[model samples]
Target chain A: MIDIQLSERQEKIIDIVKANQPITSEEIAKRLSFTRATIRPDLAILTMSGILDARPKVGYFYSGREAMSFFTNQINSMKVSDIKSLPIVVDEQTTLYDAIVTLFLEDVGSIYVTSEGFLTGVVSRKDFLKNSIGGVDLNKIPVGVIMTRMPNIVTITPEDSIIDAAVKIMEHQVDSLPVIEETVINNKHGYKVIGKISKTNIVRVFVDLCKNN
Target chain B: MIDIQLSERQEKIIDIVKANQPITSEEIAKRLSFTRATIRPDLAILTMSGILDARPKVGYFYSGREAMSFFTNQINSMKVSDIKSLPIVVDEQTTLYDAIVTLFLEDVGSIYVTSEGFLTGVVSRKDFLKNSIGGVDLNKIPVGVIMTRMPNIVTITPEDSIIDAAVKIMEHQVDSLPVIEETVINNKHGYKVIGKISKTNIVRVFVDLCKNN
Candidate 1:
């Protein structure tokens, strides 16, 4: 894929096409006082880029497709699994202090809480700090006691697009999301935390996009 | 700007140009068993998109420019000031408790510290969480006692690109950066906090790019 800036004449051609739908190249050229050969390349670019649709005998029609659609397509094609990081999970019985320690040790923004190897809740540094300042005994309280519980946590599956993950993070005002897969634990349904996506991850992807470009 | 996926024949034309660079259009057409007239549109596209360069009477040469260069240019053109949020700031004498309160009240990941309207330090949720768990007297210690002080804080000017901000955030492993402008405060050279760019801002930009596209 390649991106190109439209020349002035090409822009004029689009304007002309918009003003006169199904206009033939000859008419377009005549309108601009240029011969058909002079504008053929411009027409080719506009049509090839999908800005203009050319029917066999129907001349040109505006397609209304923007150039940035390529950017959107590229982002949408990236799956969460392609960029997710390993989630830091702690058992429900683990003390808040231990969980916080794990967060520090792993340098992760949030920790996933699991009960019997299935996702139950999530705790972030904000949650930990809020509780820490509230005079709670970090060593006595279980991490699950302070977590945002299941069904309330915003999550994404590996199959979801990274754009979907980014949207959830922004809309929910959360720092990170757990990438999970639905599972059956014994007789009950649950989600197994498999990966993690955070604002940091999103930023990394953004940097990488620019870097690779 | 527009992005386009090269057609099969267009791709073949590029391959031919790469191998026989400086070859004329007529020669390229002969190799592909097509008339020059039939390949004119493809040559126009390859040359216009900068994937191939055509010199008058000298034929075409591989430009070696990738399509994503447009994406890179678009991102680099965005200035930090274009999207930086109002900085959440606190005075040096404000107690850690009050700083934490400000952090919550503003719902920002980090808070900038100022002394006489000049940036002096920065404190993040992680710092607060660490001190909160350390048995420190949050109500007694001033934020200046715990913040990552000047010269240590990674900062950006308003003129810096948002890409620069993202790179610094990722490299420093920090949640946010203070947008600062140099100033003279009581004859001491320092930076005055102007705005802030955080992981959240980066995510928002990423989302907006996809949305706009």
Candidate 2:
């Protein structure tokens, strides 16, 4: 993680930039009740950090990409609770048709396959493709028939950082993470999903934070 | 548009906030080679504009969502280039299976469809689903056969704001935007596929921009 250390003064300057970027340093000094001469040095430090862009007469602006990197560098600070939405799971007994409809309506790319109420496997859009583009029976074939089963699953706790979660997505080459309460990912046992986190959700959180940066 | 006027001091504070947030007012004073006493009031004024958030000890931060809202508030300062990226489209003659696979591999939910290299229609997973779900010939059928024909599509340009792109996604119930070079979409004459933009992309961009803060 890049420990972006900002002195109290530097921090205050960043706050000001975020508050009114694509602005001028002279104007900023007036608003913060500081003098242009005082804020100038601080602005220089920020520019050196590649955190802010300065236009002589026009003023300064924050680079959105740069600002977001500062926070994500330490995504370990994020908790599973930070991503609170739960995912709707499907039973292995569920049919292909149901899975398709569910996936579309929920706007998710995959679903956990469970038996009773525990996760047994995972089925994705790719899994559905193997059988079609043909009309087929969703009821006859169990979701477990195509799902990538336990022991091969990747799960995260509510306490995991956003960076940790992002790594899993990249490594697994999967679109989403099934947040589990308890994990014994083996065929003999089962994975119980409590919630879900997708690449989209992670991105959403960062974007929201940047907006407020 | 959110025409909140900025005092010179307020502008400086905003600049600083953008440079580095999760910062304290005391830090701002030191960096500018000034005293914290001088920066507090200015910070307070900017915060009152609803552009920055100041937590007594935590310092201040920027507000991006509010900025996005302002972009959407009117056409005055709003430009298509703001939210616009390049465009990406596929040939109508392309097979359905190939398109679906491309969408999956690219991690994108939709792709623009065209004929003779001109915009003609749009094919989304949902559009494919109603027919693709049943056992059918994704290989044999041309994507043009299933895509949403041109002139009926909703799109935006490079000058538009992020909010405009977002609103289009929500309104069309579509997940992405295929930035088109041509003002008019012709099903038979597809435009050059420059880049792709999506809600997911927006989220990712934001998360990336504010990772540090």
lDDT of each: 0.91, 0.65
- State each candidate's clash count: 0, 85
Model 1 residue B50 lDDT? 82
| Candidate DockQ scores, in order | 0.58, 0.12
Residue A202 CA displacement from its true place in model 2, Å: 3.3
The TM-scores, one per candidate, come to: 0.84, 0.57
* Candidate 1: segments with Cα more than 4 A from true spot: A6-68, B6-34, B50-68
- Candidate 2's displacement at residue B133, Å, is 2.1
Worst 10 residues of 1 chain A by lDDT: A65-74
Which one wins on TM-score? 1
Top DockQ hit: 1
